[model samples]
Target: MNYIIKIIFLFSICTLVVAEEAIFHKNLKIKKDDTTVNVKGGFKIIREQFYKNFKKENNLDYNFLEVTKKNPRHGDTALELTVGTGCIGSKADCKRSNFESKKRVEVSGRKIGKKDDNVWMSMSLLIPEDFKWGGRLTIQQWHNDIEVYEPMFETDIKNFVGLTMKNGSRKGYFVLDKPNKNCSAGSGDGSTGANFCIKSYQEFKLLNWDELLSLKGKWIDIIHNIKFNSDPNKGYFKIWINGDLKVDHKGQTIWKTHGDVEKYFGKNRWDFKFGIYTTSKMAFKLYFDEIWIKRSCKGLKLKRLGYKCKNLLDQEGGVKPYSIKDISGNPELAGTL
Candidate 1:
């Protein structure tokens, strides 16, 4: 029978190359002018930087970023962000709404510390249950490139940490942006005081939409522990999701130069973007995996990656509060939730 059908078609091509080498990993594929990638101590990451409305003549060639292995929440590959629907934004000159054009795919973090340092980041977010809710979504952000202005109370300083998600009536909340002191003055040109601070921790809710669709397909382990000071009693900003301890928070969190701290000194720091930045004309498919940054948790070795770093960080004092019914323990808290 033709040598038993060539041994069952080469054993079905060696079981599809061992199930695609157990979920893709040909050097962590991510190319499209790959900017950066190299993790595990020596640190480096600034990969897949698309967005300027996915430039290249707005052609969307990279097709909004991908490197999927299906459901990877840890290893083998996972970074699939898609934001389709007019995609315009290079300042959206030919606007079409969605707040005049905004839709993004991100991955930024290449060191921009200083001012008390102490950074730390970790990721693994997956929200696929057919995600599509009204507008305003900004997965994560700690941005502050510079916008200090008080050259005469024309007011436009800055201080705005981020992490948004919205959909009021049909219910879907997850917002955070704490730190308040919206500067209306100070810094006639000395920097660090056009402070348009922020404050919106939306109490945390899960009122409906079937408890926000029971948080779609799962995998949500996030962690961020910053400490860049603007001195709200020595700045702080802690967060941890899946493993609990939601938003420890303290103050300021960062935003110093805008005028002349020696002409923006090291030029204002803070940078750590995440995928999916939306104004939402509806269309998004997010998933990301084991993205990490370290400064501790033994520099995030995480017990050699098997993880059990005791809910992450606490090398003897500070950043406590673990399981309290799983992250902000939902059950109806309103606005900015």
Candidate 2:
């Protein structure tokens, strides 16, 4: 009898382990890159449900009220909204209220090249303040251009990640200066500009003209290797262009303020902001294939927590109307890390 009871207990333990292990690897899609883990089959984003949750989730608030633009220079379907663009307003006020009310901000169903040509769509997620920054933000576009920005309110500049454009152009520039006053400007030529401060976060500076020219035709990847050291206000910032070292800064200081992080994250801590911003006189197009965010890891074992692929079909078997969860799945798991 005793032996039988022991055997039963052992079986139950084994079954529990198997169940937990299955849950971990069930929706995983692994890649050649040992560090990459494609996520799958979790909480699917139902557009209507998600919009409702966006309002109910008090921890986070999104402002995506649509505005109409009159005599739009573009086609009848001039403006389109994608993932991140919808949340332009919160309970407080419209972040884009400064823009002309007539300048419409709506979601379009058109495709930019092989990708969807959605305009003015922005996505934001509320993470815990103590949540460590992991993974990398990968943005790939085919014919449309995107503007990526990180506004860290509480954390300093060192905690912030910079943006890298691939086969595209970006306008407008802002620099973080001492005290409260910061420098604001636009790109000189029709090229993209990197807005970073060297004094605060070491090596967090814009790419030179020559470096920018080199990455014109090909894809550009910018990885922010953050070093969390003694000073909470200081850290390191490094960038890799096309898998090559481009910018590396040590002992960087990033300003930490309630307003900065709140402006982006709506709470405070670490947040990422990215969108498509064209030149005032002209509109640009760039196609994005993938966008992901990476967190800091010991050694070189970095983990890809979140990623999105373009043109991902939905479960309904249709392709016209798109969504984030349709194509964005967890990186598959070949084995264990």
Candidate 3:
């Protein structure tokens, strides 16, 4: 406990993914203010201070975000995020409703790090019993990007890397991209220049649906370990659900969108935000709570939610692969993995 294992991020990045079909809702009670009815008023001072710290350090606009007691993961309060349909009559000014608005209750942190750095985050998610449980919903994700102009194709290449989810069976995933040269360009200085292209790394599922669904109607704990701004061969990412390892990937975790990519090597920092994000036009509710970030595995409260995340950081070094240490009813092989 000597190390400060977690830090709270009160992010305020307004991201309204437009042109994409918006969300819809069902029998939920709607307040006179047009918001879906739920718990109100009951805020945690500790959580509020964390939010305030984020505002003071980053100074991002969080007008669309909310922190209330509508629901919580552990304490008397939690963060409730609702993604509403963009059109209902013609009130295009629904805070973040179409005609150019925001999406989800987004909160961004300061930055990932100054390249080749490791960052850890922990939180719990509660998918309300009434949540529209269908289709692919990106409840949470890793994202950071800055566009760059590529002269080779005479077009711009948005160099980006991050994780995404889909098809709603309550799943989480991460996709990898192999950095490869796209094409060669003629250099005015008489040297051939090359552009980069990323080959998709098939599809990597990080969350176990069965284990997650088993805890339905309750808060599910999660921990994300990220190696920031590392190139394809040097980066890594890991995720632990409750107390099980779901993703233990060791490869590039970040890349520059477009630039002299090499000059800023290891200087690029990443960011993250979680809430309801999906292409399905249905009503849904996503709740979040007890989110904290840390620099290493120094002081994270793994057993905070009744279950302990054993074998933590199994991929950091020479840890063995995941296996059933012992089989049930087999006393002979008990204590063996």
How do the residues 161-251 of candidate 3 rate in per-residue lDDT, one tens digit apiece? 1122211101111111322122111111113222332222223344335544555578777677767544556666666666566566565
lDDT of 2 at 260: 49
User: Compared with the true structure, what per-residue lDDT tens digits does model 1 show for residues 1-337?
Assistant: 9999999999999766433311123223543232223333222222223233245556654345556667676556676666667553343322322223444555555545454677776666777877656555566566544433211000000112122221111111123242111231122322223333222222222112453357678776666667767655777666655655545655555544433533653345665556565555666777777766666655655443355566554433333322112223442232112
Residue 327 local lDDT, model 3? 33
After superposition on all CA atoms, how large is the RMSD of candidate 1? 20.0
TM-score winner between 2 and 3, please give it. Answer: 3
Better of 2 and 3 by lDDT: 3
How does each model score on lDDT? Answer: 0.46, 0.26, 0.41
Find the candidate with the highest TM-score and give its number: 3
lDDT for each residue of candidate 2 in 230-317, tens digit (9 for 90 to 100): 2333453433433344434433222323234335423212223232332122222222212223332222222222222211111122
Q: Let me know the TM-score candidate 1 reaches against the reference structure.
A: 0.27
Weakest 10 consecutive residues of candidate 2 by summed lDDT: 318-327
Candidate with the larger lDDT of 1 and 3: 1
Which residue segments of model 2 deviate by more than 4 Å?
A: 1-206, 228-234, 251-266, 278-281, 296-337
How much is 75 displaced in model 1, in angstroms? 8.0
Instruction: Order the candidate numbers by lDDT, best to worst.
Output: 1, 3, 2
